[model samples]
Structures are given as structure tokens and as C-alpha cells.
Target: MTQFEALPYRHVLTVPTVPTAVRLARETTEDVLTELGVNPRHPTVGPALLILSELVTNAVRHAAAASPQTTVIYAAGEDCLAFGVHDRHPYQPSLYGAATVTEGGAGGLATVMELTLGLGGTAVVRGDADGKGKSIWITLPF
Candidate 1:
């Protein structure tokens, strides 16, 4: 394994649920991926960033009322990159089922599932201990 792959890295950013959060999250994710020694030009990284942007956009759009703020997370190790978007809304949607949750097979969550699975990655949701929130995490190996 490369030196970077042998080391663990992580970052988290919590921001107000607003339209600007999408851009902020995407930019920060790219920066964080660089810090984790991930190649920006990598094919999987592009789709991964797109997936993360969609997740943050979804939170800002749908959970803004109950979740005034959303968190973007990044963690990497063992030659894999992992990240997630967390909101204070209690509903934890399944990424697999999200494919059919939207009309015409087009939605943030649906697209996330498609890209993640298509890349041989994994996506799952983890509920907060207090049960008032959840985090949707995606892990992709580069």
C-alpha cells in the first residue's frame, strides 16, 4: 500500500442548510479528498463528488425545516475513501430503495445509489444515537 493509503484521515464540516451548502460541500469534499491523498482526476472521484453534492443538496432541500444545519463528513483509510452527509431529520432513507422512490428514475438519492453501486462501492445510512438524525455514508475504493 502507498504511504497515504496506510494512514487514516478524516474531516467534518457543519453548515447551515441553505442553497449555498451544495457548492460549499462539494468544494470542501474535493479539498478533503486531496488531503487524503486521493487523486482528483480519478474517474471514481468525480462521481463520488457528484454523489456527495447531491446528498448535501437533498438535505438542504428536504430537511431544512427540521434540520437547520447539515454536516459533511470525510474519512479515508485502507485504500478507500468514505464520506457522508448528515442531517437532523429522523427519516433514514435506504439508498437501494431510493432508486424507485423518484419519478422517471431521476433523483438525488437514486442517482447516488446508481453511481455508488456501479462503481463497486457501498452506501448505507447510520442513525444518530439520539434517534433524531441520520447520516448517509458512501465508501469507494480507489
Candidate 2:
């Protein structure tokens, strides 16, 4: 019998706030999913990529503006993968409802929410480390 070592919830990554980071995030996430038997051509891939893009963009734009030294990390647990974007800004992200979703404002947040919901997942935004910054996290069930 072979023993499988249990994984921890601390697979963290800190990437720069540049265009390459965005590409790297999408590619790395796709690779992770594929390595876990998730087909890249699956319908869910589109929305997943879109969510990743929006979150990363926000990090590079808003978060980076407030805190230039931010890094996005991914922590994988037993049944889910959490995508976290941590910035140095000491503020929380707000979620928009259906009205904003249709109003064409707050599009990135809305898109992330919609994609996460459609994929049977949830999106979370909270202040990081004593509320010195924010981390926008989305948990996707595997």
C-alpha cells in the first residue's frame, strides 16, 4: 500500500503586477487544472480565465496603486482551490448586486461574482493582515 501525503493549505505565490503576471496566472491556473484532469477546452475554462483576468487586473490597477508590492497567491485544499490577490492597500472590496451588474459599472467585480456563482463557487473579499490591505479570493470546488 502506498501512503499519500496530505497537502497543506499554503501553496502561496507572489507575482509582479505586470502584464506577464496576468499571462502567467492564466497559464499556471490552466496547467494546475489540467494536471488535475480538468480539460482546457471545457466550457468552464472561459469563465475561469475571465475571473482570473479581472481579479489580476484589479490587483495591478487598484491594489497596486495603493500598495505597489502585492502578490497573488493560490492555496489548494482538499476539495477546493482558493485564488487570493493580496495588495498592500488597507481597504476591503465591495460587491455589487444585480443593479450594478446591469448598469455596466463595477464590471470586473460583477464578472468575477457571476463566474464564481455559475461554477458553483464563491468569491470573497476581505482586508488582509490587520486590514492593511485586501485579498480578493475565489474558491472553486474541484
Candidate 3:
């Protein structure tokens, strides 16, 4: 098998469901973005970090009740980067009617949608095809 067959993707990172996982998520994502020559100071970078932060936090908080293990996430693609986080819960998260700057809670999906849209990309979440859990994903053009 060639590299594409052996690896199939570019990067993958996982962290246990803990409070500090948000920081780790941001750091790891920034590292990958930098490795791909994306400037850390770019305006979009901060929102991307926030997207990851909220999504990961939700995974740690609401994804699973019985056994919330480490959150599994990966970033990969050719012309764009896609970030996906899989939590242990299968129930899909509900998005609020609308998002606003004044709102402050239960905005994970809304936040991800806005950030991805701002970056000229898309975000989506669905139940895992394997019927195990759910994976929330965001894709942005480089």
C-alpha cells in the first residue's frame, strides 16, 4: 500500500474528556494549521479555535452519560481542512432557533455553523453510520 492507502488522511488527534481538553484541542489544531502554513494570527484562526472549544466542550459534557471516554477527532483533506469530533453519545445535538452575539449558552452548533460559514466553509453533524455515536464536522477552505 502507498502512503495514501496506508495513511488515508493527514492528521488525527485525540484527548480524554477533561476540562483542559479545550486548550489541548486549540493547541493541536493551531499546530496543524501552522504546519500547513496557516498563520496563527489570521483572523479566522481565533474563530476556528472557538469552534473547536465549544464542540469539544459539548462532547465532554452532553455526548455521553454513562461512559464518556476520550473524544476522538481528526483533521484531514487535500484542498481544504476538515475537522471532525466523535463523542460517545448517539443523540444529535439540537441547535437553537437562531444565534446572536448577546446569547451566551447552548450555542455549540450555532457557533460552529457561524464560524464555518464565516470562513466560507460548511459544518454538519449526524449520527454515526455505525450507529455507535455522533460526529460533528466542519470543513474550511485553506
Q: Against the unseen true structure, what C-alpha lDDT does each candidate score?
A: 0.85, 0.69, 0.68
lDDT (Cα, tens digit) per residue for candidate 2, span 1-142 = 1011233544455777766777877877777666656667877667877888888877777766667565666656556666777778776766545215764464778778877887888776777657788777777766
Whole-structure CA lDDT of model 2: 0.69
**Best of the candidates, lDDT:** 1
Ranking by lDDT: 1, 2, 3
TM-score of each: 0.89, 0.77, 0.77
TM-score of 3: 0.77
Identify the runs in model 2 with alpha carbons over 4 angstroms from their true place. Answer: 1-10, 77-79, 96-99
Question: Which residue pairs collide, candidate 1?
Answer: none
Ranking the candidates on TM-score from highest down gives 1, 2, 3
lDDT of 3 by residue, 2-38 (tens): 1222333567677777777778888988888878777
Give lDDT tens digits, candidate 1, residues 41-73: 988889988999899999998899999999987
Candidate 2: pairs in clash:
89-133
Model 2 error, position 117 (Å): 1.3
On TM-score, the stronger of 1 and 2 is 1
